[model samples]
Target: MIRVLFYSAVSFLLTSLSCSAEQKRALEYTVSFEHRAAHYAEIQMVVPTPATGTIELMMPTWTPGSYLIREYARHVDHLHATSDGKAPLSIQKTSKNRWLVECPIGKDVRITYQLYCHEMSVRTNWVDRDMAVLNGAATFLTVAGAESTPHRIHFDVPEDWSRSMTSLVAVEGRDHTYVAENLDELIDSPVLCGNPVVQDFNAGGVPHVLATIGDSSLWDTAKAAADVQQIVARQQAFWGVVPYSRFKFLNVISETGGGLEHDNSTLVMTSRWNYRNKEKYEDWLSLVSHEFFHTWNVRRLRPVELTQYDYETENNTRSLWVAEGLTSYYEDLMLVRAGLIDQSAYLKRLSKSIEKLQTNPGRNVQSLSESSFDSWIKFYRPDENSSNSRVSYYVKGCVVGFLLDARIRELTNDARSLDDAMRLLYQRHSGPKGYSNSDFAAILSEVAGTDMNAWLAQHVETTDELDYQPALNWLGLRFAASKSEGTVAETKAATAPTNEAAREVKPAETDETPNDKREEPRAWIGIQTSDGSASVIITGVTHDSPAHEAGLNVDDEILAFNRYRVNSRTWRDQLTQLGIGETIDVLIARRGEIRTIEVKPVTEPTEKWNLKPVAEPSDEVKARLAKWLASQ
Candidate 1:
């Protein structure tokens, strides 16, 4: 009697399952590639249940990850609606990116449109005879009020294409069919279809796929996979959890080079032959690490201002340094932690950033927070005076990250570091509504168990010069300026041993020249040039320099120097052979007006900086140094 009851219950459950499956309406999208020859994609969206009063569809003006509004709807044309039985429905253009449809109630509606996709970018769509990359924001439309509705997508690939890849989950027992839970997820997932080489691996017990679109025969994809696996493992350990079950790394080999991060995947464009060179290969690895780290940073631990993205306009925030700059700091740091790069190489990269920040006059004009806020206008749109007026949040932010890590380590006595603070942010602020900059400062202080208000106010909120002393002193090192002309490392510090101290007060090798063998001092023109033109154009004249004092403005064409025809390629060499404090005749064409002037060149400024170790250090200093530079 119990067996008979169980059989009847199973039969009823099976019947109810079948009925539910039959009742669920299918929301399907079909993308056709037959018309790709004209750079057009035919997209048809089928809605099983039509709305009663009015139905509105919208194409996003821009995509996430990339902040600019590209107006994706401009590429759409020939859009019309029809009933499931092929009866035409009336449609009207409501806005720049919106379309309205008027149809009878309780009828199925199918909207068909054509997209002209020739722009080749990570955020846009590109279709050719060889391959097709479809970004959801540029290809799909959403029902105005039904953004959370589930979507089903099908691709009609070309005959030559062998496979398709995306991060979205695939439908059961279906070929090239995927499902997205909502409009945001659909836009976040990009589809690539072509005869590409794909390699799959498991990192931290999670599946990861690397897909290559262009020629990759020269690339050692196995080595890349191993390195990426290491990166994934280290990052997993850092955050203590992996958010996504499966991830994808989509690499498109082309002449252009860039990378964009997504929720569960990343798209990178690079040269086909980059793997052949060691430095280029390491750079590629750094790029991979940078984008992968974003999975936790900007994608989740974003600023409150960027918690909810606005697709139609600019979303401004004062915390991009935390987003992009801190990411920049970790790009190379992760490389070292993964054993892909050494400590020396990491320091070299850090010193390079220091040189950039120290040399660019813009650092004195723009604060780190202000630079982050004005990125949409000032950072992206730059002029010749940009170096003199604005600083990059990326460069300065990396420096700040370095300083903060060292300071935190000093305060916690190697028991904690910035890594701990980052983990706290990830655990507490990973939400749709993110924490603000003030909240971040507070969290940082709380994690480090110290007051960071003064540091944050001085370095981040204002344009005050950064003091590298705190960081360098902790490492038993000092910052010094270089006087050597060729090498970036001219290792003489302020307290460095002098000739007398080294030679036991033997002899002075000072600026004294033998009477018979006097050498001419080197001269500086202080004018940067642009080459490959009929006449050399002065690109810039340094402030308070001889060229600036002589009124040799930018864009002034140099006709001759010392009565000799001046070539931009040889001008620097000529100046090198001249003596300091010597006046030279210069013929220039200022705004098409020819004139001659005599200007005296002076000695060049010694501003190139270097990082050098201290001669003698305290035991506490040595211990701190070891703790800071210890193996990650």
Candidate 2:
């Protein structure tokens, strides 16, 4: 056992450190998906060793590519450790994080645990009747202090499931055989359990697979493969090489949201299975391209600070704007080259980003890097004040990427482009190389033959607003800004419309509902309860809300509204039937403590997230449009 753990560590450090960005580490493994009734499953890991120590096992608090610390370890359960056969050593969670064990310092150890995979979101793990979906980082464990050691993961995958496909470091043969160079390499690999609906093809001398879950009935493979190929080819051409011999696209078909990247593949949560709409289908392909671009832009080519990741702490960098935004630039570019989208669509996409950037107030407060760094604190846990205080690197970063592309073209008289800049960086730092704010400027200056310091200082670092007019004029376009709102029709009881006429009246027919306007206060009850079966379950109570003012706490089930029996889900509708300042007695079920309380409703919480149609399509918009139209 000691020898096994020690070998795993040595393999990881030796292999991962020696490889360049252009090279890929091998991964092999077998995974078993046990359908634990209707929700979640059980998984076990048998890892080979290189050189071990007192290995402390841990699950990443968050995924690297996602840019947020999701506290993944919180859900892992019943973890136990074993050493070969030496009476299975005991492993206790030493910190809030790692599992500490005093064993044969350098050897092989097998660990097992039960995971509660109940969530259906793409970001969460779910082991249900159909299959089990696990992100490599979420399921794979690491050697406490030996993160740099090389490793190989062997899975006791069930034989019922045919095979799995991923760009993760692995080779074909036994279900439980693959290599990992280091902790980062291990974390970078994503594994799929159960049947992965795969479509195999190639681009730039490497194979590509669109491995999706559920069904693949609606996929337009003819148009898809070409666009996908172009996506990889473009990035390959830019970097002058394809880092991995093979790549995988892990598509977790759902009904909403996006994806995150990894070393050789990407994990995407989308609406691909029930995909019926043509618009949605093409859009999904674009998303696939977005993540694929990151294989180089972010996963490999990164800001110097990102070369080595600190899974336990914040690894901040300003270049994410470029790493991510430039990747955004190519999402469309690949669509164009592949003919998946055309010129009109490409410009439409860029124009939309322009409009988004123009209207956001956060543009005036936060810089791109600030948004990128604060992502851990702000991006994932978005709430009411998010918009007024923070900006998105995605929005502004795309614009800067566009502007940089144009600048590169203009400076070299159309002879070179930002593509050259990206390629140069990839080749130079393909192996653990990084850049600083200064390093970034030097690179751009070298490629453009001019100073890009001022441009970046204002746009990338400081809060100085964008000079849209000039940037658009340079690309031959226009800009506009307008207030957008949210949907009001669906909320029959969310709040009492201050406008008496609006009491019974419905929301306007416009596409968007009014934004978080500081309009007249309607009424806020300050209780988060879901109405169900003519009753309400009080999930939480804010500090001074009418509910809290009167007295309320979480886990209290509401039995009635004003003595009228009403369940949790329907309480809101019942409230909208009444008017503002209306005082009511609430009935609830709390640990057998049946109680009634007086409360008044006020205005709802302030506006936070906003999404609207594009209004400003700038000069650089054409590139984006071409990509979108081509995707179609």
Candidate 3:
């Protein structure tokens, strides 16, 4: 009798523990797309009520990676709540994204709402007759205090929709149901409900799915998928680890642009016709490489500031330069290393980034750290003067990354590169407890065998002009000569030869006539104009330019230049005909009032920043370059 009683008690304890586990996952959601044609998704949630007699629900204000407050609650309509007995419960809006509901104690509560999801971006939700792309942050509302608890979602896909795809773990014996370990996993996983062209491949012994929607038979799906596998293999080799069990690349060929990274998957949108063009297709591949690199950079090894995300409000960080900029730097490099693009193509792409940074006047105003911190306000919300005041962390950070990589190579005599530093950082801090700015510098210092804190601070914290001499010399590369008389400061710095071998190499010339050979300098009005139906509207005026000095404001209609009638098509040509240092009458219409402003055109600044290898590189330099660009 004693043994029998002991066995019965142990069984009872095990049953109680199982019941407790089930209760933690008692929240169930059913999403139906009955009105998808109208771009509506109906959501039904069932929650197990606590003994407190009240519960709060919250819809996330913004999704991760986008860094903008989208106010997802604005799309919710016809929200209602009820008790287990079907009795109506009192529901009140406590905040813009929160709802308070009163229900019977120790009972279950049912809540239903309709969401209108028509936004076409990767961060938001979109549903039409043909398909539905749903982001969890914009689609589901969670019980406020129960975010750590498991949540199950069931998709009642439409009859015409073939299947649903996501990175979430599927529930066994259920047709379209999936479970999330926690709210974070649910939000990180995006779902696609449609008949997308699915392709499967394995890299690093891990399964990957490439699902392309809206193909329309225009995309080279097979080749794209094969190339994507190569990218995956290259990136995995770089990291030396495959972090996830499986991965998915949710490609949407919706004639759109942009991509958002997730933990185990990514959503990338592009036009179907991009595959036919070599440059555009390579650009799409670059996009893929960028988002994939984030799996190791931001998604896992992140800054301390972004270690824990606050979904309700802005999560500020001064390390987006490292997160996004480093990713930007590696995106194209990865493509070359994967053998998808040749070395020439890679250099061309890198040169464009350098050119963009050199031309943007904001590089002198905002430091990379400031750009990362103020991305919520200044980066996303740009005005006419943004170009003069705000720099892109992605651009400057990428340039800085290139210089940093070269600096490391120089310090260690090519014995160690930035790749070692990244791997070391990942080994030390790729977890919930992220590293600080100083921590990142320490890693670089360790790899380079020298302290880099001061160097890092000067580049990240101050808006100081970057010195490109080290990178140019170490890489045995030079900037192509400018067509205009006054080349930018960086061009002058790059022109200095590294060795006697470099002296034998003739500087690469642009397609335009040389500055000394040209008959006249190119005249610049310094205004970017848009072609309106009836007039040429000034959209932007460069800072300290002739247009800005003459008070040429944005939105001013330029009816003519030098009193000669000119539209947007003819304005530039006519402006070019005018002599530099000569003031000409530019007629304008401000708010329908006819006016004329005198403006002096100056010689256009040289903006060429093309990078090319030295024509006569020494054997040593050639070997270094090979090591830098070779596949891992």
All candidates: TM-score: 0.85, 0.71, 0.92
Q: How many residue pairs clash in each candidate?
A: 0, 92, 0
Which lDDT tens digits does candidate 3 get at residues 1-632?
A: 00111212334544543465475745789999889989999999998766688999999999888878889999999999989848999999999999999988888999999999898989999999889999999999999978777778999998888989998877667888987767898999999999999999988867899999876488878889999999998888888877777789999888888999999899999998899989999999999999999988999999999888888999999999999999999999999999999999999999878766766668778999999999999998888777778889988899999999999999999999999999899889998989899899999999999999989999899987778878887887878775453433434336432332221111111223444456656677677666445568877777777888899999998888777898755776687787788999999899889899999987665544678786677899888888888735
Best-fitting candidate, scored by TM-score: 3
Model 1 lDDT tens row, 347-399: 77777787677656677689999999898888878765676678899899988
Ordered from best to worst lDDT, the candidate numbers read 3, 1, 2
Residue-level lDDT of model 2, residues 348-379, one tens digit each, is 67766765565444566688878877877886
TM-score of candidate 2 against the unseen true structure:
0.71
Query: Native-vs-model 3 lDDT?
Result: 0.84
How much does each candidate deviate from the true structure in C-alpha RMSD? 8.4, 9.8, 7.3
Q: What lDDT is reached at residue 573 by model 2?
A: 59
Q: After TM-score superposition, what is the CA distance of residue 399 in candidate 3 from its true location, in Å?
A: 0.7
What lDDT score goes with residue 66 in model 1? Answer: 72
